[model samples]
Target: MPDLPPIVDLRQSPTALRVQRGVMRFLRAAHGFSCFAEVSLANGRRADVLGIGPKGEIWIVEIKSSLTDYQVDRKWPEYKEFCDRFFFAKPPELDPDIFPPEEGLMVGDGHDAAILRMAPDGPLPPARRRAMLLKLARLGADRVHTLMDPGEPL
Candidate 1:
């Protein structure tokens, strides 16, 4: 078996910090977005950085210091339901093929950040898209477990 790469703790690694800085800079320059670091979602899931794109598209970025951390989290599916775009950030050495080819955005360079949008092709109905956007807006504005308790709106 091929030897697995050693995982590094992001909280303590300079490379992880640089990747984070690159992600922040990329978001700022590409989308004029304000990165909400470690924002708690209604489901008690915290995203590394949530950015609102210029077109009102919601982006959820999950940053991992190591490939192993990314593999173990397994929460990207939940994030997809909440945001229009879902991204995974880590060092470039991590293979993007590890992510689901149809549903994940890979973001990072060994020294900077790069992103690939993996949204499916074809257009959603305007009404459905608008409704989803509204839900995202509400979720971003306040915290409520609408996703959990379907009867409640926050």
Candidate 2:
């Protein structure tokens, strides 16, 4: 096998550090409304941030430094199964619309930070939605292993 490049530490890059700090600050502000950060899903997928609104709406926020990161990842669809609302966080220059139209909300910075809610023109059937939600709930509750363990009969 060929050698791979070493991982670059964002801490050493001023630009990356600034963006990281911005994301942290945004998450902190969200915490005031009962939102929290770094919530882990049962499948080992850690959402960058998660928050529940007073009315019980679940929000999932995924942060990216650039549009390319948003485009290449496959996890966003999986994230949709878990939350009623979803958001992508990036700098003001990045256009959130680059993502699929049906996926989720787009939150960008301008003035003091603003959000645009993107609705899926065609939604999944209610039954399918419920199934996905249940799967995600189990994952979040750390019960996925029970379902996946080979020792247990299906």
Candidate 3:
């Protein structure tokens, strides 16, 4: 392989990883969304999980491994600007009551998961939605390209 930029991994704890996997599986299996992880939005905030549905609807999922993890990460609110709905996913051990009802809630483990609550519809403006779709498409394409051609710059 030729010289390529070193990519920074989005490392998560085993618990966090399990939560993420379950959320991803639930979204794809239940909602038919093509989910992507660590997607950086235009505002410079990276969403832990982002999904685009068949009708171009966007959703962002933030995984919290524990109560402390939830307290530490307050950036989830900013992610709302970029998606039609926002959700928080956590392991079954984490209590769902802690999450705000205004947003969605999901519970899962390593294998599979389910959405406990769905976020209210908050559709993006037409222009913003278009821009976001373009960004997601390009990002998805670039990621696939990197997997295909390892030597390419990310």
- How far is each candidate from the true structure, as Cα RMSD in Å? 10.8, 9.5, 2.4
- lDDT ranking, high to low: 3, 1, 2
- Candidate 3, residues 67-125, lDDT tens digits: the string is 99998887889999899999999999988988998889989888888889988889999
**What overall lDDT goes with each candidate model?**
0.62, 0.53, 0.86
Quick one: RMSD of model 1?
10.8
| Candidate 3 Cα deviation (angstroms), residue 146 | 0.8
lDDT of 1: 0.62
In candidate 2, where is summed lDDT lowest over 10 consecutive residues?
2-11
Over 1-154, each residue of candidate 2 has an lDDT whose tens digit, in order, gives: 3222122223223433344345445544754434434556656776765655454456677766576676787876676666666766666666766866655544544323344555343344577556645654554444344434525443
Better of 1 and 2 by lDDT: 1
Q: Give per-model TM-scores.
A: 0.63, 0.54, 0.91
Q: Model 1, range 43-127, lDDT digits (tens) per residue?
A: 7776676776676666777777776776687776666655667777767766666766666565665445666765553343566
Residue pairs that clash (backbone atoms under 3 angstroms), model 3: none
- Record all residue pairs in model 1 with backbone atoms less than 3 Å apart, i.e. clashing: none
Cand. 1 TM to true fold: 0.63
- Two-way TM-score contest, 1 vs 2, winner: 1
Better of 2 and 3 by TM-score: 3
